[model samples]
Every structure is written in structure tokens, then in C-alpha cells.
Target: MFIAAYVLTGCMHQPEPVVTPIQQLNTERYMGTWYEIVRMPTSFQRDMSHATASYRLNADGTFEVVNRGFNTRKGEWKTAVGKAKPIDGMPAGFSVSFQWPFSGGYYIAELGSNYEYAVIVSDSHDYFWLLAREPRLPRWLIDRTLARAHEWGFDIEQMIETKH
Candidate 1:
């Protein structure tokens, strides 16, 4: 009875998984183009394919974000320009605004050592994206990155791979 009770208590005391963002993000090194490898679906990006996000650092330490993608149904390319500002005390956190007076959280939760790939998540945890420097990533790498997202308590079952 004691052993069973102890097991139940342990099971109830499991710690919540924490999302750890990168500690030191070099904005200079990160300034470039990144192809969307996979993402959790959202209305804003509906029917988007060959999606890519390009970043350019401004002299005042802000970043210009240009998100481009092809609309499969419309047979045309779409683009949105936004501004990103670093969040104080959060090395990998930024507030991105595409429209006036409206912004959203953009956090670099996980990144490759050489900045080859990155896992992005928002404050709501509903938005997740996997990005890479190149359009195509190795199958093994995709699998591994998805596994890591799962470990971080994200629902990876609905992740959709982007076509590039």
C-alpha cells in the first residue's frame, strides 16, 4: 500500500516542461533568410507555400521582417513587411508588428549551434514553426527537431511540412 501510494504521489508531482529560449542570440549572424520547414496552421498563413522569412537589421537595433510565400490557390506571391524589436532581458524574444498598433510575440525557442536551423514559438504556445537556412532539410533532422518540440510539451501531431 505504501509503495503504491508513493508511486501515485510521484506521478502527480511531475514537473511541467519548460521552454528554454537561446541565451545569447547574435542578431548579426541571424540576419538573413530562413525557409519555413514546418508550421502549426493559422488563418494568416492559409494556403501559403514556399514560405520564407527574411530579416534585416537596422542601425537602430530594430529588424525588418519580410515574409513571403506563394498562394497556391491564387497562383501568386504574397508578402508582408513587419518590424521586430528585441524584448528587454529576453535574449531570444521579440515583438513583431506587421500592422499599426498590433504586434505579436516572436521567440526563438531553439536554435542550431551554427544558426543553420531554428524552432520558433510564441507566448501563446499555439504558434510554432521550424525554420532552416535552406529550403530543404534532411529527413533525419526534421524528425529530430519534431521530437524536441514534443519534449517541450508542444502538440506536434498537427505540424504541417511546408513545400518549398
Candidate 2:
């Protein structure tokens, strides 16, 4: 009994698996600018703030991805232009190329009913970003978004709030 109690108390809790991408995503409906609200610290976005992403569907069925942010240290805006190609059979999944010949997985984990907010996660399980159509989301919407993300097994505690 003591050993069982100890095990129960000391064991690490596993994070639940995330749900599959939404049944269908209207890529056209998702195109536009989105401000980053929270995200994981990563080399790509290090020391940046006021981050925003824009998407534009191309005639070739690919999409343009532009990431712009202000470097805190330099106090200047920096931009990275990338391209995204949809992964076959996955409505919300894309392979994004920041440079030629190299692409990484991008998944739309969650999207708001009106396309007002989105939770994006990398296939590597290493990157996450909470985005909104506006620079800041309403408190209630933020709470609702967080609750939904928590239910889907995202570690909310690991999120770093993005300063605008």
C-alpha cells in the first residue's frame, strides 16, 4: 500500500494526445494577417515581439507565408518570407519552406468559429503559437481559447506571452 501510494504521488502525468485537425479548413477563409499572442521560445523567433503572420493563396495552389516582427534589441522590423504547400489529404496541414529545398510541418490545431483566432502547432511537437485577428484578444475569448487548448492536451504553462 505504501509503495502504491508513493508511486501514485511521484509518477509524472502524461499529456493527452492532441485531436486530429478539424474536419475541414477553408484555406481561403483562413488567409489574412494574424497577430501572435503566445508562443514557445524558439531560435527562429528569438528576441522578437509584435509578431504577425500573413497568408495569401497562390494560383499554383501553394500559399505565401510572411512573418514579420520587431527585434527587441535592434528596435527594427525584420521580415521572413516563406512558402507553404498543403499536405495532401490534410485540410489544415502544410509544409512550409523558409528556404529553398527545406520544409517543415505546420498544423492548424484549432481555429475559432469565425476565423478570429487560431492555435497553431508544429508537427515536431516543439512549437506552438496562439494567434488572433487583432493584436489582443478579449479576456473572455482568451479564456475560452485557453480552455479549449487545455482540453486538447497543450501545456498552457509552457506558453510565453508575446509583447506587442
Candidate 3:
């Protein structure tokens, strides 16, 4: 009984998963449109294709976030307008709210030096997205980034390529 108790306690005390964002992010350069190259399946984005996100900085330093995608099943375009509030002292972190009073973490875990590509994750590491300035990225780069996501505890196998 003591052995079982010790094992159960150890299991309950496991550390939370860690995902580190880049040290710095230039919001200005990060603005504009980014095409979604791949992402973990999300209910709201089901059957989405040609997914894209646009960022515009507001006067108050928050960001106006617009996400668009073509729904294959519905044969129409869908868009969601939201706000991204940057977390002070966390250059790569933001709280994005699509539905008012309910926000989720938007962290840039990996970013290219030139801002050409970026890997995004939430604080819980449940949401993952691979974005690029262009519609498509080189196969090798995608593979490398996916590998990095795996290292960060993401389930890369569940990632679905976005059609653009």
C-alpha cells in the first residue's frame, strides 16, 4: 500500500510542460498578413482551407487580429475579428480574444530571423500553428519546424497542412 501511494503521489506531482517563446519580437515587422501553412485541428476552423491571419496594430498598442479561411464544406469564406493584447514584459506573448471576456494565449515559440516563418503555441501547448509570409514553405523547413514542435511537447503527427 505504501509503494502504491508513493507512485500515485509522484504521478500527481509531474511538472507542467514548458514552451519557450523567442526572446524578442518586433510587432511592427510582425504585422501584415500571414498564411497558415499548417495547424493542429481546431473545432472553429474545421474544414478550413486557405487560412490566413492579418495583424494591424491599434493606437493603444494592442493588435487587431483578423483570421480568414475558406470553408470547403460550406463553400464560403469565414472571418473572425479579434484583439490581441500584448503582455507587458513578455515580448512574444499576447492574450487574444475572439469572443469578448474570453481570451487565449498566443505565444510565438519559434520565429525566423527575417520574420519569414513562425511557430505559434498557446500557454497550455494545446494549440499549434505554423505560419509564413507566403502561402507555402519549403518542405525541409516545415519538417524541421515540426520536429522542433515535437521537442517542445507538441503532437506533430496531428498537424494538418493548410491548403492555400
Sort by lDDT, best first: what order?
3, 1, 2
Best by TM-score: 3
Please provide TM-scores, in order, for all candidate models, with all chains considered together. 0.86, 0.82, 0.88
- How far residue 68's Cα lies from its native spot in candidate 1, in Å, is 0.3
The local lDDT score (0 to 100) that residue 112 gets in candidate 1 is 90
Candidate 1 Cα errors over 4 Å, as ranges: 1-18
Q: List pairs with backbone clashes in candidate 1.
A: none
The numbered model that scores best in lDDT is 3
Task: Determine which window of 10 residues in candidate 1 has minimal summed lDDT.
Answer: 1-10
lDDT of 2 by residue, 1-164 (tens): 00011111111222221356665898999998999988766766778898998999999989888888888888888888887777777788776777655556667878889999888765434566789899998888777766776776777776677888
Q: If ranked by TM-score, best first, what sequence of candidates would result?
A: 3, 1, 2
Residue 31 of candidate 3: its Cα lDDT? 94
Candidate 3 residue-wise lDDT at 82: 81
Can you tell me which runs of candidate 3 are displaced by over 4 Å? 1-18
Task: Please say which candidate is ahead in TM-score: 2 or 3.
Answer: 3
